[model samples]
Target: MRLRFLAFLLLASGFGLSSASQEDSPRIGDPYFHSSGAWGQDFRDQWAFDAIGLSDPYVVWDALGESPSPVIVAVIDTGIDWNHLDLSWGSLWTNDNEIIGNGIDDDGNGYVDDRIGWDFLAGTNQPWDYDGHGTFTSGLIAAEVNNGIGMTGLNPYARIMVLKAVNNFGRTRTAYVTDAIRYAVDNGARVINLSLGGPSALELETAALDYAAQNDVLVVVAAGNEGQDLADYAFVNHPAVITVAAIGRNGERSTYSNWGPQVSIAAPGEDILSLRARATDTLMNITDAYKPGSAIVGPDKRYYRATGTSFAAPFVTGGASLLWSRNPSLTANQVRQALLQSAKDIGASGVDQFTGHGALDIGAAFAADPNASIVAEISSVHVVQSTDGPAAEIIGTATSDRLEIYRVEIGQGETPSSWKPVAQGRSSVTNAALATVSASEFAGASVWTIRLIVNRTGGTSQVTLYRLSLG
Candidate 1:
């Protein structure tokens, strides 16, 4: 049997909808008759969710199957209640190195016993949502699909690394945020989503975002809800960040969503339906903000309908992860740029400060040139100094047309241009094509700079050195 979508709109400062009940949730057609389809699939919701593209990739059936490599999207927000009925399973990210409840820093990455993602808000391992915001964003990003319930996330199998940088009271210090971003990067997060924003242009935050860019991690940040131009907003202005603005069902800028040139793209942000845990909204549950009559509640978990740029950012984040996961060769920049370029321009034709490149379009992203010869990552750069000799190893991966990997450069200086290769080596296909160089490759001990030069498109390929930092 087909189920109708139970979406909602914000009627007040908290979770709400009119007097609508679960029974009153709207559907466009007659009651759905069963199709010989896979589990956990929702065709109706896909149409509602695709404020970006008209076509639904998930309807392709094969797209519902698990990918070989699921990308991890770090949701750095209030935290996530992954244990919620709709969100507790599937590719929700867990720290593989961490052991749960042992009370020890098993992985030795500082935070202890963080089996699931870390909670920087309380400095604990369990990132259970203290507020409902993260869970809502998490569902929009990846709420597990084909399992047969609720709404399907943008990317069905993409993992969510729950990082709670914001407190229950809706406050965050820059230090916590900086550490959270670094933690997400170091712990194998391919995409990071920041659903919270403020007016502050802090130095450390900018530096942390820069660090993420250097490490080849994509960051999707939310424009604030003050409904003003955000050209001066540090996070949105940063070249590394994909700043998102909220659009409504009518394909217009959200009244409460911030706008301007800094906005990278627009996405559905009004009355979005997502998973919400009653435990997190105890105070809001009693007030008019809580729409009990309309609440789709049962056994600890209920669905919420809310609006903000907070919800819009995750659509782009999930899109980026889905695209990158499908083609492991695309560089972080390539994935970000290609997705931006594929957007369906809205508002005043072409790009504008209000919508940037316009609304997100996920289905169009599949048309990206898979053999575009992308150098995806530099996983590690390590130096081992022993009694025999001193050596450095550079390990990274590349895509299809990559001819070979040669030249590992390390330079220490204030100037970025003044760097040279220490050693040259060949590459072979591992999972993706991997290049290896070590032992006697060391140029200097105080190496502050690391560069990997990959040659694509034959000798006609110009030496594009992928620059990174050991510091």
Candidate 2:
């Protein structure tokens, strides 16, 4: 099981994935119009935004250019308003294998004219949104950025596959969800988002979910909103689904959000602003900003604030999409593990019912994904024989069959509950090297951890402690 780590202070910024060569990170356009989550500045209004580490997703986007077209993410909810200004068709999934406007299942995948995606509820070629939930969730996952119409999501360039499983009325049948899952897996979707769930499980839906898992497609599902503990999640319809819970902007469990052990992680779910549908229909019936700055007025469109476990699940879904964009070869399980490992522990110590592993930290997730290969540990915790007196200095070694330069990080804390980075690198050695920690700093800290991670320059990174040496 992955144990949750306490929230460290704003980590060292400008962290890039450096190979032994240590080249600069890849480039992209400027960031959206909000406070970027880079240097620890709190964009107070959207606490969930910074809480989930969305402050600096642009760093990943800048380093990793465009996501591959085939790495499509299927949002299985109410249909999306693909024509919204914040959504770029460039990032929208198109079934090029099938010809559009032709009344035929050209790709022979059982659907006709699925140009971008299918509408399982309406059984039509147009998977457009008549309601706002799908649109809200979609914008949170992959809103077009720097093009400057509205705000951005995790990966600005991630490809989205629209699947309408929930209708405008917020009603859904097991068959609709099951069929949508099958459709997404059949297509090139690497990640599937199910922002809707029921109070009970159906055999067909369970089989469909298992099928996605078996086929190596990661499914991000929402824990029910009953606000009651039901096993792992507060309440769960599917006992074994990759469940998610909801937290407010302040990083507390939402009053209506379900919780428990079943929850994997959490994200900003309260009044999360995203793309608004052209139609007046809505799920929460919230037409405009309930408060000031809640919704952003765009050039051609508007993004409104929404709340629910439904909105929370997309944070993980979008994260999975970005990881795949960084490296498509990563397996579904690998993606899931990276997310769980990088999560921030909140509320109670370790994994609690309310916040699961804690709120999603995309920056940490990027740094802790499957790219790094070095393992480090504190070899010996010894007090140095100083010329004047006994002092503290940690000695550690690392081993990586992979030839790459590594850097050592020394963090100090008064108690296990908190840690602050005391020292960072200048030493970059290949394969084998001793980690150097300052005696003065080490002596001051009551507790500490040593990290020896790769200093490679690739577009993507894994957010992990690598081999940790707790002192």
Candidate 3:
């Protein structure tokens, strides 16, 4: 199968800067729209961070205090500009096992002198981003934070393991990705971000996903940019993968984002500003590369703006890294559950086709109880759209050995303080309908909240919240 980088090029801007080899290397900072007070003094173009409850990461950081252990996130794409100014030495992964430049496979891992990362296409050590896709994805996951630099990544503690699987033209073969997946897992990667996808599913790639899961490595993939239901897409629906969809800044699914039952979560993907690989003309030749403004390269030639599910996957990869950094004992499935449970639910009543469990919530994921499965829980809740009317059926699992009653309630607003019960005093059922919510009930309100109250046999209880939206 032929895989492609799942992105829609929009804009590329930068003040022509010299190469990294130069003595007086140029300094890169936030975008002009951000730093010049064009949007606002405090505003920056990285709205995805805030959308996922990462505006202030101190909630997770303050608890860890000082240095958080770095989690290796493998970016399998068109390589990365490892020398990007905003990406420091500390942010990228280094392979201590492989000795560099001696012309021998010191580590005996099949590759010679693979110190930093391997380039599968060239079969060399230098995995430079000739197409700029991997560099952009890497920045979203592990760009240096709070040095007054370009952009802030979701996880400051993410050490990017640059794996070049795709070529300059943004295409990769099945064998390349399959090998990259194994290499990443063997090289100590906790999370693998696959920002590329294809139409057909190959056996090798299918096994690769299983290999990652077997090794307890989390795989996050982009739900391709085709904007169609991915029910027939076998690659994304794989049990081991957490497929991510792209949503705009307004919290609605992006027009180009593919959707299906397989969609694990959604993240901000429209006009997302990130690092641009030097000497790469990814968006330069595009038809409307500068729709909002004319091409102006300036103060920061390092920034690139684009949209797609490709950009959205890293936000989740970064979030997974943060969770691992906080508590290394978290299983890949546990981390996946934490992400789903802590997500800021949007669209439909619950785990809908568009947003899945909901949007990525890094802050909540960090604070989420890692051992949540042991207690009374609400595994999932989703809207079953009715064929008859505006009313939809709410169905999901709320089960535990110590369960007593589970109540479903609805309230107005994003985070409602008051909730009125819609379905109450019901016994636990493995897979059964909970309640029915009509659009007419909450007239004039577009946003509402669905509260799942799981009261155990004892006084102990567990409360879970899901966001509901209607036209």
Candidate 4:
């Protein structure tokens, strides 16, 4: 009986139909479905959530208070399944100026009846998912949380603005994407996630990116999966775009992810479980050879497990929306700074080529203060004779809008690329003991650079430099 069922499913897949009925899919009452041994493998699914520090978002929810304003995020890819069980209709961005199903260009933006969003592929208003990439990414960005049915999204306060530009075969030209970027920016989308890209760096696409940046919209793109260095990929390296890389369950760079100097951050992208679009078998068809029977995650066949930088990009997109939802006053640059500065550093200290700043840490991002500025100056530095041998006492006055901690670091030479922390203080000080650096550390150096950094609640910091003569 099982062999016969598998054969029938394979036949259905060949005909471009869903292997299982959508109505009979898993729900809350099916106690065994999500936790069942066949589907879940117990915590193996949804491991990305914990990896990004979203294991329990209630603390963030509590910090955000009752209801934060919704941030609109544009998903420019294959269309999304808006009616998916886990996706909320209320969370979708609606165009108040346009009348739905009117067959008229009510708002005069060119596309007629673009109530929710426009589909450049089908040239229609109903931009429903047929290729499944958009649906998968949308679910990652704004799937309803605590609904007791499927996995929770990173941001519950985001309104997804679906803009379908890619076709059913996951192929898209630069023109379609450029048009979609303009539409998203004009339609009040604060963040745009581009999970599709090719090698070409067309002028049209760069112009659209500039338009978005000029309009104060944050655009996030995925580093290609070619596994080759993308140091010269102009599209992903654009100043206006935030290029993201992929990390696996172990928090290391995914074997297939491309890396380069342009990568701003990394996020979970391996074995990711998200919504499976109806009548679409992109994952099943692609992974049939290497990993069979693993594409379809649940008995209900409503979830999928796939891996790519495409999936990793949405986690940052979702994080951007959540940050905007909490602060609502952060500029596109500020949001980008907070995300990068607050990342959990991995692979290399400070910043590196592979992971950029590091893996996404949404919890720390929520606590970041990108707008905070420091007014500080180093007063003086003097030699102090101590029993421990030659120590330098540094004095400084530093203050910030939201000062939480301050650090003093010493490095060899008058201009050092890196500095070592010598002392740290929690409170604001006025010409007080900012740091006490031991001369023994840099025994051979005659001149040293001392840095005083004022850190805020978030990972953002402001620095003041001073050169000291240690002769």
Model 3 per-residue lDDT tens digits across residues 1-471: 787888775423432332221111123333321232222222346667668886555566666656667799999998888788888889989989887899999999999999889999999999999888899999888778676766666677888898999999888887888899999999999999999887656577679888998999999999988889785563585666889998876788887889765787899887676778887756543335344332223355676767788899998998888888878878998998788767777875556567777888887887776656412223334445565466656665676556778888888998677878777755665546667776566676789877777765656455555555675
Tens digits of lDDT, candidate 2, 331-414: 887777678757887775444446666778877887884644333333344556666556545444333334345455555542
Off by over 4 Å in 2: 1-32, 35-47, 65-70, 231-240, 281-301, 369-471
Q: How high is each candidate's TM-score?
A: 0.67, 0.67, 0.76, 0.72
lDDT of 4 by residue, 413-441 (tens): 86687788888877788767777767687
* Candidate 1 per-residue lDDT over residues 127-151, each given as its tens digit: 8776677887888877765455555
TM-score of 4: 0.72
**Which ranges in model 3 have alpha carbons more than 4 Å from their true place?**
11-43, 284-298, 374-471
Native-to-model Cα distance after best TM-score fit, residue 11 in candidate 4, in Å: 25
Cα displacement (angstroms), candidate 1, residue 119, comes to 1.4
TM-score winner between 3 and 4, please give it: 3
Give residue 98's error in model 4 in angstroms. Answer: 1.0
> Cα lDDT of all candidates, in order?
0.63, 0.62, 0.74, 0.74
Score residue 321 of candidate 3 by CA lDDT: 89
What ordering of candidates by TM-score runs from best to worst? 3, 4, 1, 2
Candidate 2 residue-wise lDDT at 461: 24
Model 4 CA deviation exceeding 4 Å by range: 1-42, 232-234, 284-293, 372-471
Better of 1 and 3 by TM-score: 3
In candidate 4, the residue pairs with backbone N, CA or C atoms under 3 Å apart (3 or more residues apart, or in different chains) clash, namely: 368-458
Where model 1 places Cα greater than 4 Å from the true spot, the runs are 1-47, 59-67, 282-301, 370-471
